[model samples]
Target chain A: MTDAPKAAPATNSRAGTKKELSEHFKTYKHVWVFIECEYGVIHPVSLELLGEARKLADKRGVSLAGVILGSDANLIAAAATVCFEHGADLVYTVTDPTLAHYRNEAFTKGMTDVVNTYKPEILLLGATTLGRDLAGSVATTLLTGLTADSTALAIDDEGSLAATRPTFGGSLLCTIMTLNYRPQMATVRPRVFGMPPREPGRRGEIIAHPLNLAEDDIVTKVLQFVADRDSNQSQLAYADIVVAGGLGLRSAENFELVKALASVLGAEYGGSRPLVQKGWITADRQIGQTGKTIRPKLYIAAGISGAIQHRVGVEGADTIVAINTDPNAQIFEFAHLGIVADAIKLLPALTEAFRKRLSVNRLAS
Target chain B: MHIVVCLKQVPDSAQIRVHPVTNTIMRQGVPTIINPYDLFALEEAMRLRDLIGGEVTVLTMGPPMAEDSLRKALTFGADRAVLLTDRFFAGSDTLATSFALASALTKIGQEFGVPSIVFTGKQTIDGDTAQVGPGIAKRLGLNQLTYVARIVELDRDANKIIVERRAEGGVQVLETRLPVLITMLEGVNEIRRGSLESAYRAASAKIVTWNAAAAGITDLTKCGLKGSPTIVKKVFAPTPRAEKAHQVPTDGLAPEALADAVIAEIFSRQPSVESDLVRFSAGQ
Candidate 1:
């Protein structure tokens, strides 16, 4: 509206809800990871968190504990065993029929109740949809701090949980700290950390808790759970080698060059977010902050102007090879190898070369 | 029925640039637009209001200049626009920001009929935290449904809402009551362009501006930095790796020759990739 604004009362007053930092938070101890278990399967990110939590717990001279909420006792026990093998020194279980599915009300209440009863200095969760849903509600209910999509976590000299994440649209990085909040909370995306080596038959202490919530009290009801039939095709996140193209390919038809290269190398193929939006690639194949976070052994990016969003997703790759005609493309800063050439031309050449090399080896074999 | 859609005016991240030497965000010529994601939320709310008899009030908490975004929302057929602005809100993190917005929403409910549903984009591009929607829901004690892809059913008489939520590997059909908070996933619906008559209406629409006090926020500490639990201790450019990409000279080199050279470089750097490939090829 270009019309004059109807301003509030002239008094420049500052008044809102006040939540004081608790003084007894010093008593908070140990590092805890929320073991995200749904449909009797544990999310890999939960185990990855346990791996990193083990290091942070060790640094603080505290035990690494995992809090698992579920309806079935057998599932909970099995998940606890997996947590122990992954790195958890202790497991906190809350078994309630209401806690079976990831309804925000029950899970938030269960998670907050555990934190309030047994105060943990740090609480970690996966940045998956369910984890984010519960973490935000629980953190707000507890009046605590929570950093989302943290790329790194460490214990500072003063023992605060320092969570680092991309900020300002991923153009810059900032390190955030919950200086005075109990259960300094953070949510990390999957594949940001390495999976810890599993120890078979590892045992951990189990502390059972009750989720005092009743089914009637929970407002939201789950009608049905429909698993994606083609979920297996979206293996971009777990692929060992990824070859992706970008907008610079000129047209959707040219994207086939990327697939040809990937086919020859026996690798996965993906593209930048623009390609997905342009309908050149499916949503699952989009790689970036909003898309899948990938940590492949080898990543080849063609014609992609590595924006901040794309950088965060592929930064985890061990060795990145960039092919861009623009000499100053941002991907070169992070790529291990660079070729300043047109991807459309170079991709087919690379595919032919790889195919020939492999075929020659086939003949020898 | 009453609907409230939370909007944010953010620097077009596409135009935001970093200083080459100092690494400071250069906000000089960067234009501000309604956060791209919030458009889906706005469009969805408008659609619901058109389907059911209701008013859609677009709300935002930012500097006074954020009214531009509110006006933009009005042009897109929002019935009303409310701006929650104050200097105290500067440097507010997601938690603090949510507290302020939640307080404002409570006041809006008191003034205009209590909202049946609140809407926000899945996340803001500037902060990208995605905590505010759930934070507001928890503060207001509303059911929270995030990353909602579709609203399957909405029965005003029954006060029931069914939605398809995007989960880890599937779509979850969830049923909840009225007065819930939703963060709509992107690409759910495209925003519509206003008609000429709607443009004229928006041009004269008076934006209701509220300060912290007017929003019925009773505590000063929680309105701004003092309320935030997390502190940004450092902001810096990502440190460049120890070494940059070793450039393969492409001058006058044929595509095949360049490809061979690049392959040589890859094997030299990561020998395992070559070995892994060879083993896989032999197995095939």
Candidate 2:
């Protein structure tokens, strides 16, 4: 259905100058990370952000803080302490019963209120479902720029938060700057940052912010929290080693072969986007940009000709072993090890070999 | 039950590549498709309109050529198509883009009946930000449901909607009022092709075109690059790994032998991984 075409818009029109950078925004200071928790347990991405923000905070010579929103005061106080242990210099929080389950309306209003009262130069959030839902609404409410799914966050030359993310469908990377906005906001994907070592007995300042939202104000309600049927809980996010397959496995039956290898090697099993689309695996088992990002010590990919979307997810792997029939597969370009063979055959053989080797080692020991 | 679906035309990411030396996106040969994600949304919207007595209007903000995507939507049973394109809308980021689209939606309501629901793809592949749908919902004061796996129920008479929304590890069955913005996750349903008769009607359909002023936008500064707060300072391909994939020779080995050789090679290269694997996989 391609028809008449128009010239593509020229990509250059950045509003020139420090003149547009208003004086009122100068009052904004420090970097803030939204410490998201569900059912009392702090999401690991929140801890990951503390480390990333710590670096940016040090670069700009500013204090780093975590904003914890929860339903109970005591539970939130404990979460705030963990933030201190994970590199945050201070904690800003609000504890209200309504804050328990993530409702976009209440959380957005609460976060927006805090940002307006105590502006920060940079505000970070995990790119989780809760964080994304809140960040978009909050950023819109604050009338600021928000860079989403950022792979990297840094302090620019002008002391602005420079958020780097894969753009154009991960074909390339672009650094975004919210030049004139207060609370330059960004949502970093999980596993993009390492968990900074906790300093036991670390102390930090705690500031409790008041949340104005009440139950009656929110339009949406959490009818119930439905835990997934398959409660393996998508450990791919934190798995030390992952074995992933793609459509190259040929069928869901063949997918079990990938899982067999992972089992023998004592690693987690995952697949590319297509396998998830084919219903061979649940969405949580999908690994790529749109799925869980992983930084395992070892990643074995079979039959997956890496798309940029999947490439971004696995690039952090300490070692990547690619198996595909196509020698020119994009996975081969970056994989530490490559094999030109059918994953259907190679996976099963690999599983048997690993089983024998591991068993022999166990017997000898 | 008037529904509006937001559509975007993006380059086929599968065909897109990067320049090795220059590290620039080579979009020269890639064909533009109606962002594949949006098709899922279009199908859902059309299905609702078919089930209920209503109209399905498709809208998008891109170059003049984006009208082709709208026309294609019509072929899939959309009743009307609106294209919002203007030079004043160029260089807009997600924030500015949402502002323009929301303004256009308001005008569409004033012109053609108020829409009860606004549907959009979870995210555009080109942007991959997944921010615009929520931004628009916020601007227009619509209840936003994102990454929806299924529409469990839509009660036009009761002015309510229930959907299965994908959360971190679970699906949230959320209920909301009408006039909500729903961003459909991919693969909820297969897109249907048009019948020949429908294709004929789509070819002859009159597409509505709106410029910034025509779209009822009040401020000029908030229309384009001036409105956008985020600026891209650098766009480059990621640096390649220094050590490329080391190929394992598979010339003269049986399947078992090949596997054994590969395992031995892996151990020799990463002796620590062998110990690490042993410790974890040994039921520890």
Candidate 3:
């Protein structure tokens, strides 16, 4: 129920006193990234964040630190080594058996403790399922502002972290600032940033901290982890060349044309978010902001309208070819090459052409 | 084993279109419906309630017109519906939105009982951030299970829940405690239609309406834009690419010639695809 705002008791005798702007701006410090680790391997997005953090740290003349919490010290150390090679200057670790698997209760507690103890001005995390689960909790517990799925991060003239991200279903981009918050927090999607080259000989300082949490204190238990079978995996995100279908394809059977083209291209295949919503494709094959971000060398978008969410996902491609019947389809706006034609007719023709071309090239070679 | 579902009335995204001349979203004549994803959540919640023998309450936050969505929820066999509407609640982002929902949940707990579980769709099609569910869990201190494809088991008496969570590469079978917030993925369950009697009851049901002052929100600054940290300063249409598609002429051309011309264009754009095709054919 709504209630009227109550009058505040004056706790500060100098409530009206003005403070100097220069003195007020000195609270910001080093940038910190939340290193998301599960099972044993660290999520690539975590390393990617570290790489971006390294650039921001250099620009701001500050150190890049990584915050990691888990059960095994050795695993954390290994992760820290990878972070160092990617770019972290220091790794703050909290180890406890309760943290072996990700439980919001324990992971949030461990992370908040690290943040409060070491007041980093900027914090970054991967926008993965586990990272999102923990980032919101930790940010809320600390009563700070957080930006999600940021596409860009920069240090402004005021020494504040400015996070730019797509908004309103990728219709627009907005830059958000947490001016009053001590630590500016953000979550970035995978593959949005390029991975830095690894230097195995690189090293960083590891600050081992005690995790006061225990197993009994943790309320949730990990009964088991059923890793998705390799055969069932979509591998859409890692595809070098992706052929995606859209509503323009018309029927479920028509999707086979896109698949045939993808087969000849030797690329993974997917569809627009609309197709997924229409039940024509599974969620795994949906290529869009909410679905997947791909960085293929080439992308063939057939019958897609190219909404902002879908555009953001494929903007990283080196070359994009769009095939659609609508001359003014949004897909053509962003495509490197566009054809105004029926995908149903063009798809099969394209597939056959590729088949013959490759066979002839093979014979000649 | 009572379950509470938080639903939102969203503009049908598929119907949303940008003005041809102005290049701005024309929200006019866009019909509002229960967010498509939320329907799946409601269905899963109802199915669970049927199996576990408990009441299901459907709650929504929107303009007064959103009452229609709540009534629709009731037609789907929801035991009760609540609508939290207030002018001050407008422009609330996910952060402010979650804070308001969390307070309403507290009210629901006092009146009925603390829900054994709370459900929301993975994300609203309009927002597409998938943050509000996590935001609500953070405020209420609920165990969050997101992207849940299946609920493997639930033992209320033992305070346990096992679910198969959809992850980037695979599914994770996680076991957590009750009183958790779960954002159900699509394809978890198909929504069932209500009988005639249920539809009639929904049509005439007096869905409870609450304002900001009545929802137990004491802080005015934490209710709407004041409470939200993120702000959208600009909105624009996507920029068009610089080049047009290379057309393969089919006029007066044979099928084989047309196919060859198209192939030449594709190879001219991406020569490396030839080698990739070689590898693929080798497998075939």
Candidate 4:
């Protein structure tokens, strides 16, 4: 599908006019979360973002809204209802065939248009593939500020959005501000925010906007949507318990120790980005800024030096236990519990211990 | 089918050290090299150019000293080199960085035929954001392909390309139309050394230099700090843990004894570890 329309005169008043800037900023109200959906399924990160947005909305004393863009009317309506149950006061729905698959051109155009038409002071998005792709483009188009992979979000004393994210490979945390920009934008990594209790039967106002752009004007074509093979998919983000290895594991062969522990815990397995760089593991098993974000109940990190990039990806774990020979490793700084030992040796021990404890518990039950 | 590979000069992160007293990275005198990941992308571009009998151009956006990395790209078989340098571009994060690069790419596209394929390393080790590639793809309207492990197939005549994309849990085999931007994953291919002739050419090749104005960027507001979305308010070192490693003494002990002692200390400190080992052994 292609979308063709004469480029609408950019309604973004903040682009050039100086006299109207103050009025435009004051007129903007409410906090909006862009619900990212793919293949007709709403991503969990979208819900996580809505939960975060609700908090921001509460703090700002403004209504929280969820914006859904897709072709399926029913799906958009359902997502809007879910958003309300999760804490949104209102939901804006934009449905069109062109909006079905996420083509950067159409999706960005659609979402940015909605943002410009109905101004929101704060806009939040999940740091998923689709969200990241769309956020960068939309921010650039609107000439607005956007912070990516933020771990924390709050309104500063000056009433500006303060986005805090780990930087310099997770060695430190830096708070960024999009001052003098309308609709302050930020994308938070999945699992970083706690899931809000869903109020089932809760509902909110649904406002539908017509998609004006025709399919022909869109330059990029979606030849086909190839869903990832089920067998090859890594469910690391959703694992209840996870065991990940790092360079401290010493070699690729040592990664088996990580897998061994993961198997015992019935958890997913992964490693730091360096392990993938070292060919010790595949890219899919990478857990860091550029990799998968995990929020397991318990996370065991073996021989990992927790760089900021890797730290952002795994900081959401309810409990983090680090096993590294270097007691000075960065991973220990944030870990709930730590063992200063070689992962190669300690991993097998931990795996065996967990196996025995679980078995004994099973027998007792 | 001229190809352009954009590479960055980054500090060797493995050798990077934080000064104990200053707590600042000891970047001075640390040899800067072409970003390791970029080498894989450069090699892939060279391979494509070799098979198609075309030229590969290398471009970089950095300080004047970054010419070294561009020359290095030339030695890897890039036929043309361009260095975009200016004080105005300093302190430029990925957003401003991409603006300069996109300008340079547009200029190159004007001089040479528009590149069919633009290559960049999966990400710079320093930033580790992996957003620049996608940013460039968005600006240029090229099909974006990040974390490409292998080029599964290519059809030059049909202008179609298929690649194995690295996703969260597995590889995604995807087919896309060109011209596309491909960010090559590390370990996919080993870089080739420059031959004697290539080395000489690289050393002598005149690298085209451009500034913001020279590259046709008229919007001063969208060039550097003003254009960037995210701003770094501060940079500090991570706080160290309160406790250091508790060591196990093994003075005058045999190999087995030392192992046993270490194991004993571990179990004593973390008693659950002992039972875990016993259970693991039983399972096996």
Best by lDDT: 1
Compare candidates 2 and 3 on TM-score and give the better one.
2
Candidate 1 stretches greater than 4 Å from native: A1-22, A232-234, A276-279, A359-365, B275-284
DockQ of 4: 0.24
Candidate 2: regions farther than 4 A off: A1-11, A15-20, A247-256, A274-282, A325-329, A362-365, B279-281
Instruction: Label model 4 with its docking quality class.
Output: acceptable
Against the true structure, what is model 2's DockQ?
0.50
- What's the candidate order when arranged by decreasing lDDT? 1, 2, 3, 4
Better of 1 and 4 by TM-score: 1
Native-structure RMSD, model 3: 5.2
Of the pair 3 and 4, which is ahead by lDDT? 3
User: What TM-score does candidate 3 get on C-alpha atoms?
Assistant: 0.91
Indicate the residue-level lDDT of A137 in model 3.
76
lDDT of each residue in B1-284, candidate 3, tens digit only:
67899998877766766566665656678788898899989999999988979999998988899999999999989989988988777667667788899988888888778898999998777766577788788899788888899999998878999998876566778888889999998887889999788899998998989898788888878876566554443344555656655555556765456556665676677778656667666666
TM-score of each: 0.94, 0.94, 0.91, 0.85
Off by over 4 Å in 3: A1-26, A231-234, A361-365, B19-24, B241-259, B279-284
User: What CAPRI-style quality would you assign to candidate 3?
Assistant: acceptable
What TM-score does chain A reach in every model? Answer: 0.89, 0.92, 0.89, 0.90
Model 4 segments more than 4 A misplaced = A1-22, A230-234, A360-365, B19-23, B141-178, B184-188, B238-284
